[model samples]
Target: MVPGFGQNKKAVELYKKAVDALGNRQMPQALDLFHQAVERDTGYTEAYVKLGQVYEFMRQPDQAFQIYQRAIGQQPDNPVTSLAYQSVSAYLLKKGNYQSAIPYIERYQQRFTPNSLQWKKVDRLLQTARFGAQAVQNPLAVRPQPLAATVQAFPSQYFPVLTADEQTLVYTVLKPEGDEDLMVSTQKGETWSPPVSISPQINTVNNEGTPTLSADGRTLVFTACQGRTGYGSCDLYISHKTGDTWSDPKNLGPTINTRSWESQPALSADGRRLYFVSDRNGGVGRRDIWCSELGDDGEWKTPYNLKSINTPFDEASPFIHANGLSLFFASEGHMGMGGYDLFVADSTSSGWSNPQNLGYPINTSDDQAALFVSANGARAYYSQEQSASDGKQRSKLYVFELPEPLRQKVRPVSYLKGMVADARTKKPLNATIELIDLATNKLVTRVQSDPQTGQYTAVLPTGGEYALYVVGPGYLFKSLSFDFTKKHEGEGLTMSVPLEPIKPTEGGAPAKETLNNIFFETGRYDLADKSRTELDRLVKFLEVNPDVKIEVSGHTDNQGGVANNLDLSKKRAQAVVDYLAKAGVAPARIKSAGYGETRPVAPNTSEENRKLNRRIEWKIL
Candidate 1:
């Protein structure tokens, strides 16, 4: 039924006059008529709605909001409630009056059929209001400060990223000429050195921005548009850092990039997994986040949309932290205060958890993008517009101490930075490095030492034992173990690795080195489950050199009686031999020995030295 259908003829006539006055652009006359019409018949819904519309036309949203509320209150079951609910909710939400918007949003949700498209839209709005109210009530403890003037040299800078050690910073600079380029800076003691062009090969006359760096800072993946060979409007390009120079850029290829749009790349610490944004078909949103993995053949596989983290709205600027579990991105769909709030989601055993808005004041009514978190979970960097010293607005990088509440949600990480060199020559060697989680027998990360300098850095999330393997052509692969399952302090560990060549010895003795990663339970000869990763590496080594015969020796730290130690060591060596034989290695090509207590690599004094004493060693026979 038409609102006020036979109830108030005089009010209806006044509303008609008010509508005519509004058509004539007589604002004062229309307001006076609307007020008289609503006053003449308090329950006339049409008169009230017309009054509110006139108030809205006059740019008085507060008055219009009050008028709409009165119309709904006076006629709760009137058919006009739908329009009133939508109008009031929109104004309240736009004004960030989320607390006031909630009740109207609930009523708005009721007007549509359940599960209909309209209902889903309203449902999302309700969630946004609820989340916004809660966020306003409890803001994250953060105060973002602008980066050093040296680093923010340009009028516009954004998309900041850092190396695993937090020593190197990279970001996109919107130059005064309007072309974007990647800029880089190195951290001095307390301040950053002035930023310069990242590389001539990576930056071009075209646009090159939204760069992501591998934890080691050796691999860079970024977005480039125009003036380049591309598969889309903008496509991802990759470059490698060897010694101190960056290699020429290459497109990521069509398997990951499409004729549509693909940009904003985020690389895993190892550079094996890539996450980015795309507007291609098969996405849940107009622009969705997608991921691809580097195959064993070193090719990126077909990209799959990150459906769990993406919504029916755009998601951009994904940052896979050094720990590789926490994912930070910008989104317009998720429940938030307003436009493009920053959100974080964690990859769990099952899948990615629901994204949580980073919350106010880390988020606000304005859009937030390109958030970078430190490996230790201590700092976060993002881009925001601020008035410069010249009193003109510019986009600059701001950093803040990550809150303790959020810090607990992510794993703290450290890194191993070092050089891979030849043992005999003490010269740099290009080698592939892998870090494997011993507990799960899964590769934690993989990286490559720079071909020229042999420099490498591997990220290690705390609370796990790891097997580190270094492999290069014509070199005997090296293995080492790190036990970080217990609480440990420090930003990272550093060491130099010297790998021996896989050649016959000069003949003082057979070539030998301790296998630091092999594991055996105390007082037992059975191989623990965690030993499989190391054993598998050994098996592969033997397979590659099928003609070589080898001896596996076990040692003890002299803590036990000589007889018991000898027996234990011998059984352990035999166990390894048995595993190799079972794995298809010829029994005749292997020998087992027990050098218990007699062949200690280090004196059996401190626990650390004693640990070195009890180990498995392999020698070419």
Candidate 2:
């Protein structure tokens, strides 16, 4: 046995007796002997360590922690004082005593080489302590209120997700049978209805949880463990909502799942991009966030690691907002309050920005995950556990208003809800609807209207103008535009698109309709850059129907001189013809016409009427 400095023979005898008692599992006897040995020789580090270990084994961390502290005070100059400091620092850090742990870690750091592994480990612990201490001093003004009782009927519920409209909610519940299942509820006025099993096909005897939905609430991606068809310990499965019934779930296939672990999926508003947690090979950590894009051919491509947001520690519970810019997730690696803390990162033109902690009270020593933010960025929802009066732990959903300062950091979003129908028959048609950013000429989102109901929804993030297109087979595509560059109340818009059929008119001539998205400078024939999105759609239409010939015409509202109007209209019509020719349209199949102020569709008595009269129209020949 090593000598205890100060060398008391009686103390050494007591320490040996205590070790034998501990070996025989006589915890109380060991505790009494250790206390006697430490009292005889206050400089006995071995006696103190044994006594602290007994307390820790009994799950009395406070007592164990105090024992370590006393040992350090009794032998501040002893050779083994570093061990006492290290032990005390670990207990303090675990208890969130950051300020007290810092000095201990600094002292312990001095016991090793400058660049040694032990020193580096202690240095990281010191940094974590300092970061957590600062975070406690500055906390977000957040007051989380429990969700409506009807939605919290289950004893335990978590991982809540809402549709873009906030009318539908879905979450996971832990059943008493030791398995998880999905539950859903719909909003009725200010309160939510009682939740029910999402679908018979979704919940199995095994487990199904951690669900995410598309903005329209039509697509579901969730995790299932120990499934017969699973590619991993847990794999993501997809389902589609057709009318009121959900289709059967299908595995996402090998590109997204492996023989490792995968769960907690977050999908883009259009269901084109998928973010999920996986422990597959080549990950930055034991578990990391991976992303995959859905190709146009309707297949999920191979996933790639999100290195910018992932760290050498575990990360999980990713939630990508409808705006597609702000991403909220939980990470154990980032400087946070103990376990898993929530964070938000923004995707910019220069890639992802450094993640910002969501701040205290919003986060705590306990693990926090699965945070859901509203489309407007004004409200947030999450799950938290609280001790009830009965001394049982219960988890429930919560909601809080995100402060305006943080609101501005996230891009707000609004959704467009509508239906697509044939103009003549008024019958629902399954059509492809796309929202394209006019400024950048990029497709923002694409969705398909339900075949039976003709209903569709698309998310429109604030900033810039967009061109909305609805295209279906054997039908003339509908074109519309919206400008949201300025701030406005984040309310949804409703539109019903009526598509005309591709057929000859009764008079053996093609029908004429105005193209509302085409733009030009005042009195100038040069097309604005925003006009390309519309012109490109026109090019695609002509390319698909190669045998058809069309006439492009421009009209004026009689605001300028009739002679000038006629000349300006002729030049504008020629400009459309030139663009079509450049896009590979047969020049012989196109013609330009100028019908100036003479043929005004609306009376030019008001600005709105004049706006309607100045348009570009197309007629099939």
Write model 1 residue lDDT over 59-178, tens digit each, in one string: 999999999999889876676767788889988888788898999889888888999999998988888888889988998889889999999888899999999888999999999998
lDDT of 2 by residue, 272-346 (tens): 999999999998999999999999999999999999999999999999999998999999998787789899999
Per-candidate Cα lDDT values, in order, are 0.87, 0.88
Poorly placed runs, candidate 1 (over 4 Å): 1-95, 100-123, 387-393, 488-490, 504-510, 586-589
The collision pairs in model 1 are none
Q: What's model 2's overall lDDT?
A: 0.88
Task: Show where candidate 2 strays beyond 4 Å.
Answer: 1-3, 6-11, 23-29, 35-45, 77-84, 389-392, 488-490, 504-513, 547-551, 586-609, 619-621
Show the lowest summed lDDT stretch of 10 residues, model 2: 504-513
